[model samples]
Target: RLEPGGLTFTLADGAFGLGGARTPLDAPLRGRITVEGKDLEGLVAVAMGPEPRLGGGLKATFSLAGTAGRPVLTGEVALANVTVTETNPQCPEPRRRTLALPSVTLAAGWEDGRFTGRPLMASVAGGTVTATVIAQVDRRITVQLGDLAIRALPLERVLVDFLCHAQAVSGPLDLTGTAAFTAGDIPRTLSGAGQVKIGAGRIVGVQALRMLDAIASVAGAVGTLLGPGTPVSSSALAEFDSITGTYQARDGVLTSRDLVFNGRAVKATIAGQYNLASGALSFDVVAAVAGRNVRARVTGTAAAPSVSVVPASLLSPGDAGRIEKGLQDLLKRMR
Candidate 1:
């Protein structure tokens, strides 16, 4: 016992099974009910609110027998070395960033109103993020997630922890998915469908490959075709071996019709629409400049986008004045 609002209760190694009476819930119930806590940020701010701020240490276990009103709860719940700080709508004022979940688990079962977690593991960064939740809890608490798995996960920790954005890629990310949401608005009730594979990668600062190297440096060509010496550093931009994709998201709007970006002097193909909540961008790239095929069009909003070159009469005029002075010095060094 350690109440006072921080939570802690235990009732271990128990028993209670008497003369098959029949009634009084038919007497017969074993036990083990524990719930410890160290600092779960007030139960995760009473269930995910208060602007993402959850800390570590918490344990749970419930393994009771069937008896009291058909009681029977399986157990397992753990959270260690967890951390989450939030707010990085794309970074700036040190736009908060914490995210370091060394481990987490939740083997579940609860029947009735439902609540299953066949496996809900997590150990990000170093990778290993399984999933298979259910959570129905009637009256409104839907949360379905199936088979969704991601191995070797690590793509700059999913772009700086859940897409807060920041890239300099380095691969090892495999995925398989299925999702559903509404556990109190998970990013406007997420939706999903996926298949991604990336192993052996290197894409520095990707923003649709920096607007396809500023549309091949404003048509003056040889934007190093995306690779070729003199950039194995300086934040090397391309050096791929492969990248595969297949995705579909809903509410947050993400789509793809086949994305492929091979490297060692570029070779692209991408079709898309992205709008992870208003970062809007409508892609359509098909590269391989110099040897032929070169089509482009990337609309604005992943923090100022806009690339052209497709029947725009192969743009010229010193390639629109060096692509408007390299996009005003890349948005002035991204502000």
Candidate 2:
């Protein structure tokens, strides 16, 4: 029993029964319904949920076409705000995470309880995020981010919101990654790989840089005493001109092998693994110097990482002589 132009149903603050459960509608659900027809249009002014795990404040206007059984949907959805606050036992303070996307435009097709979309765009954090999203109803979800351009986003804000830690670095971050996981398995089952490029950042709260300065001073002094053929100069390690790294995550552990930082004072190569589930960190950093390589081992949690300089002999079996020769060759140039 349907009208000629289809039947229109409107609900104001209503509840719909789905799979033996009543799902409450936030604002109004207005749709043009048709029997044995190929098109249906709907508008949900606001849709909100109660569960903390499930985000709230959703608004969308969508149109479904194709057929009653299989349909294609094109829509624009926006979330006013969604905040998740959790306290990690390992962290000293409560971690608060927020995602406030003003709009997410999607042109997706739905078939067999799944929605597939390509090149979706969202407005977030004063920047544009473009990604391909695929979600299986009650099964799994995958998102592939491409060419994310975030302008002047503070690293401290990100660390405090996501990692539940104090700010350790400051800079603008650009990255791309893909994430996939089961519907119900969140942070634990999340896995992905990405590359991040940090532009002109300063590292905070690292005492090893001071030690490096002292070592550089001593090297310069020795070079001065050895007459004019020595080419030793002090290094600036606090601020970096550029930093880049590639990271891979599997089963809640992220590992990076090509983390490099270039600065006026020092150039460092970092390799390490960070446990996403436990916030634990274990990294080895090596600074290239004239006489020998300075090695520092960083371990503990991201909130409070511990750093210690180890002996240069621990680097490799026969690297000392090679480093000496390299230094000698460099000093020969100064002569």
Candidate 3:
């Protein structure tokens, strides 16, 4: 029997269960609902299925209003134990594993075909991230990421997740950035700007530190003045105390400026452009050590970058000798 009800009628408030449902990704969804006339509320819980593309547990508390065709929703979404598997064919086996994300909290809303979220915060392995996001009906999205504080975050994890690299670098990372793009054309339409700072980190899997070690050895020979101990190992790891830089993205190319890295025995200033679409990298790095400047050109993909160091040069022979002597004297006192 069907009873006809008016356009407006208050719904009885009670607990209700919905099951055997699936989301757009075909993930299993189960929820409980409570309703009162135009105002409706529900708690939807999602379970990770066999989907390899996405796996995570999510719980959302949402309130809805208006008719079924045009409804407004406001809610807070929380994500836990989420893991996104790498799907790129070029990614190595070591980097193909799942990338785990820390728990996330989002204040979200949807109205008139537009979605918005603010104060989206996450607590990850070594730091905290907060951002704001907005997506319009036309499929354009904008994101603003605030200062993300990093403390002792594992370099391997960061590389695999963000840079799509399997190499390891250990350190604390601090950064802030913003990005905007249309979902219709992702790689080409993406644009962003950011500043990054890494403190007390080591770069592994590259011989970029060899020049530093050589300089240190030369300094050590002069008046028994020891340079910063050889932090570079045979396994190709270079240790650095700090790196700071600013970056901008336009037309799929990310350009870095005023990038500086302070190593144990050498200091480097880097300028480069990375192609977001092709993963190509071209960097001009100048390493200064023992009063000599060594220019290194780094080119290739992020997955396997190549570095070529030019011959070291002295700005002025007289000045170089004086500087070398001053450094030797300082090292002697430190000893």
lDDT of candidates 1 onward, in order: 0.73, 0.57, 0.59
Name the weakest run of 10 consecutive residues (lDDT summed) in model 2. 37-46
lDDT of 2 by residue, 269-335 (tens): 9999988667788988887654456677878876556667675423455555766777899999999
Per-residue lDDT over 270-333 for candidate 3, one digit per residue giving the tens place of the 0 to 100 score: 9999887787889898866444575778788766577666634434446567768978888999
Q: On lDDT, who's better, 1 or 3? A: 1
Candidate 3 deviant stretches above 4 angstroms: 1-52, 66-69, 87-95, 137-152, 160-168, 182-187, 206-237, 300-315, 318-335
Which regions of candidate 1 fall more than 4 Å away from where they truly are?
A: 1-28, 31-62, 65-67, 76-106, 118-128, 137-149, 153-178, 181-197, 201-239, 242-248, 251-262, 267-271, 274-282, 286-288, 291-309, 318-335
lDDT of 2: 0.57
Residue runs of model 2 more than 4 Å from their true location after superposition: 1-59, 66-72, 78-99, 139-152, 161-163, 166-168, 204-238, 289-292, 303-308, 313-335
Ranking by lDDT: 1, 3, 2
Query: How many backbone clashes can be found in candidate 1?
Result: 0
Model 1 accuracy (lDDT, Cα)? 0.73
TM-score quality measure for candidate 1: 0.34
Error of 3 at 213 (Å): 9.8
User: Whose TM-score is greatest here?
Assistant: 3
Question: Which pairs of residues collide in candidate 1?
Answer: none
Whichever of 2 and 3 has more TM-score, that candidate is 3
